[model samples]
Target: ILIGNLFTGNESMGNGGAIVVKSNSKPKIINNTIVNNHSLYGAGIWMSCSALNVVLQNNILWGNKASESGNQLYLRSTGSTYSIINNLLEGGVDSILFETPYSGILQDNYMFSPEFADYATGDLHLTCSSLAINAGSVPVVNMPLYDMDSNLRLNGSEYDLGAFEADAAATIVSQPQNMIVMNGDIATFTVVANGANVYQWEVSTDMASNWAAIVDDTIYSGATTSLLTVNSYAPMNGSLYRCIISGNCPQVTTISLPALLLVSNPDGFDENPIAVSVYPIPAYDFVNIIHAAGSRVIISDINGRIVADYAALSSDNEQISVSNLNNGVYFMKITSSNSTQIIRMIKD
Candidate 1:
C-alpha cells in the first residue's frame, strides 16, 4: 500500500512522470499529492497492462501535462480493476484515459481547485475554506493512522480528500513529575495531553533502555490511561516511569522524559522486615492486605484520620472494605510482635 506520501516536480519522456504501476502489482494509492510533472503519456500516473486491482483514494493530482494524451493519468489494461474515490483531479474526470473493459468503483471525486496553503512552495496543506475538507468517503478501510508529516489522519468528522489532514495538532500539556514514597506506599504518576491521543505507560529499571509497558492486572491497573498508580511499593518499585502520547492528526507520536521513582524504607523500619503483600493499588471497592496472623492493621487518610482498624484474627489474609472512601491517598499501619510496617494505599 502506497499511503500518505507526496510526489511532485518531475519530467518524463516515455510515460508516467511520477508513478507507473506495472503488471501484477495491486497498489493502494491513498492520501498522496502529485503535481507539476510532464510526460509523453500519463504525466502524473500510468497503470500498464495486467496491473490488476489498483486503489486510488483521497489523492490530489494537479498541474500535470502530457505531450499527446492522458494529461493526469493513463490506464491501458484489460485485467486491471481500480477503486477511485474522493480524489481532487485538475482536468476533471475526463482527464483519465482508460482502455475498454475498465472495471472498478469510482465516485465522490472533486474536479475543482484544491486551494492549497502555498502552491508555489509545494505546501499542499489544505486551507480551511477548501472544498476538499470533509469531502472524503466515510469509514475508509485500513486507512493510515497518520499523514505525510506524521500528523494524525481523520482530524474532522471524517477523512479529508488529500494528503494532509485538516487543522489538528497533538501536544503534551503536563508531563509526569518525579515521585518519592515509602516502602509499601501507593505511588501515582500522571500525564496530561491534548488532542485525540492514546496513552501508554512504561517503566525502565535500567535508566531508559529495555522499557516494559505496564498492564492492567491485580497489582497494577490503568496502564493505558493518563494516570498510573503503583499499589504497593517495594525495592523493585524504585525505577523510572514515562508516558507516551500519540495518535494525533497527521500521525505524530511523542514520548515524555522518564521520571524518577524513589522508594525508601519507612522511618525507623528495620531491613529484612516482615513480608507483606498488597494488591489493587488504585482500589475501587476493597483492598487486600496479606501478612502474618494476629497483626493489627490501622488505615488512615492523608490527614492522619483513622478510617479502619482491625486485627488478623484467624488467617493471615484480610480484605478491608473501602467502598465508602473518597478518591485519595491513604496510609496503613501494620504492627506485629517484633516489627511495624506502614503502607500507602490509593482509593479511587
Candidate 2:
C-alpha cells in the first residue's frame, strides 16, 4: 500500500513512484492519491506473471503521467489472474495501464474523470448526477462497501463506480458448493477463487456458534483439494461438522460457506452414515486412518508447506509413514470428493 504525494509543476515527476511486484508473491495497492508522480519507466504499477494474484481497488490513480514505457498505468501480468476492481484510473495519458488482465473478476469502476478540482484542496467528492455513479460492479472488495460519507451503497442498486457512492450497504459473495463423497472412498475439495490465495477451514462443534476455525487452519491455501483419510477418527456420534472456508483472494476475503456432515452416532440402535476413523490422537510414528473405502492423503508442515502429497490411497486402515520427520506437529489433510478431514500428527 504505497501512495505518492509530491509538489511539482509538471505532471511528470521524473522516475520512481512506480510499484513493482515479482512473481511467486501476492501484493495489493489501494486507495492511494497519486498525482503528479511519474517515472521514465513503469510508473503507476508494473507486474509480470502468467498466474499472478493481485487486486487494485478504490484508488484515485491519475494525473501522475508517464510514457516511453508502461501504461499511465500498465499491466505486464498478461494472461495472469489479477483484478481491476472499483477505482478511478483517469486523467492520465491513458486511463488504465495494463497488459490484458483477463483472468480475475472485473466489475463496475471508472476509467474516466469524476471531475476533481485538486487533491490538496480535497474536493474529490462525486456528484449524484455524475456519470461515474451506478456504473460499477455490485460485488467489489474494498471500495468502502459502506458509504461512511452518506453514499448510495447501503440502499440502492448493485454498486456505484467511483470511491464515494449514494448507498452504503456492502455484502460479500462466496460460492458455497456442496461436496459429496462415497461411503468408503477418498475425495477432494476444490474452488476456483480469484483475488484470494490463502485459505482457512473452521469446524463447527456447536450448531449455535457459526463455526470456529479448526484452530490450525489459518495457514491453509485456497484453490486446492484437501485430503481426508477415511479410516481416521472424528468427534462423537450425532455430531455435526461443517467446513467454514475463507481466504485472501485480493483484498476481499471470501469464505466458502459450510459443507455439513452428520456422524453416525449410534442412537442406541445401529451405526450407518459414518464415513471413516483415524486413530491415536497423538501418535509418535505410525498412525492409521481407516475408512470403509480408500482416500487421498497430504502432509503439510507447521508453516503449511506440503512436504508429502499422494493420491489414490490404499484400502481401509492404510499404513502411514511418519519417518524422516522431526519431533513436532504436522497437519495431514485427507479428503474425498464429499468431505475434508484435517488431522494433526506428532512425529517422534
Candidate 3:
C-alpha cells in the first residue's frame, strides 16, 4: 500500500519503473503522485498475475514514458476487481490501462496536466488555479489527516489530489509613508498589500498610543481602502495614520506602521494678507504682538504642546507676558479676520 508517496525520476529496463504489484497481491494507493518515470512496460505501475481488489483513489499518475503499452500503468491481469476513483490520469484510462475485459470502477478520473508550482525545480505544490484543488472524493477509509507538506488535508470543500496544499497567506507589499502638506491643502497616503481585500485606516493623536478608526467626512476619504486622503488642517499637525489589513487568509490580520502628518501654515493663505509683527526676540518680561486687533494667539512649545493661549487682542501692539515661561524656543500662531501667520519665538 502506498499513501501520500511521490514517485518521480526513476527508470527501469523491465516493467514497473516506480512500483510493481504481482502474485495476486492487492495494493491500495491513495493520494500519491506517480510521474516522470521511464520503463519498458509500465513506467508508473506494472500489475500482473491476477492482482485483485486493487484500490487507486485520489492519486495522480501522469508524465511517465514507456517503450511498450501502459506509460502510466500496465495491467496484464484479467477479471481483476479494482476501484479507480477520483484519480487524475494523463490519458483518461484508455491510453494506459491494457487489460483484457476490464472489470473495475473508473469514476471521476480527470485527464489534464496538474499545474505544478514549478516542474523543473521539483516543486510539486499546486498553483492557485490547479485543477487538482478540491477535486478528490471523500475517503471512506485510510485517509490521511494532513497532506505531505503538513498542511490540512481538507482546506477547502474536499481533499486535494496531490501531495501539498496551496499556500494562501497575504503579503504586505508596501506601507504608507509620511506626508507634509500646507494647511487647507489635501494629503494622500497609500498602501499596497497582495491577497488582501479589507482595509481600515485609523488615526492617532498621541503618536500611535491611541487610535480611532477614520471614516468618510469632510476631512477624510477612502478610509476603508488602500488609499487614504485627508484635508490638512492646523489641528491635524503631529497626527499619525495607519491602516489595518485583513481578509485574504483565514483569521489573519495585520497593521501598518504609523506615518506622521506635518501640517505647515503657508504664508498668504487668505486673499488679503495682513501685516504682522512681533518684538523682543529674546524677551525677559513680555513679548509685544503688533498685528491686527482682535486676533487670536496661540503659543506652543517645541514638542507641539500648548503652553499658553490668548484671544481677542483688544489693542495693536498688545503685550503678552512671557515671564512665567521656560527659557526655550516656542511657536506662536496668530489668526486674524483675513489671514493667519506662524512666528518663531524665544524666551531668555
Compared with the true structure, model 3 gives a TM-score of 0.50
TM-scores of the models, in the order given: 0.50, 0.34, 0.50
lDDT by residue for model 2 (206-279), tens? 32244454432322233232321222123322112223222321222334534333333223423343456766
Per-residue lDDT over 172-285 for candidate 1, one digit per residue giving the tens place of the 0 to 100 score: 788787786777778888888787367889887643446899998865677988899886566544366778676433333457656667666644445556687877898999
Best by lDDT: 3
Residue 272 C-alpha lDDT in model 2: 46
Scored by CA lDDT, what does every candidate get? 0.76, 0.49, 0.78
Question: 2 or 3: which has the higher lDDT?
Answer: 3
Instruction: Compare candidates 1 and 2 on TM-score and give the better one.
Output: 1
- Superposed on all Cα atoms, the candidates' RMSDs to the truth, in angstroms, are 13.9, 15.3, 18.3
Q: After superposition, how far is residue 132 of candidate 2 from its true place, in Å?
A: 2.0
| Error at 337, model 3, angstroms | 64
What lDDT does candidate 1 reach at residue 187? Answer: 81
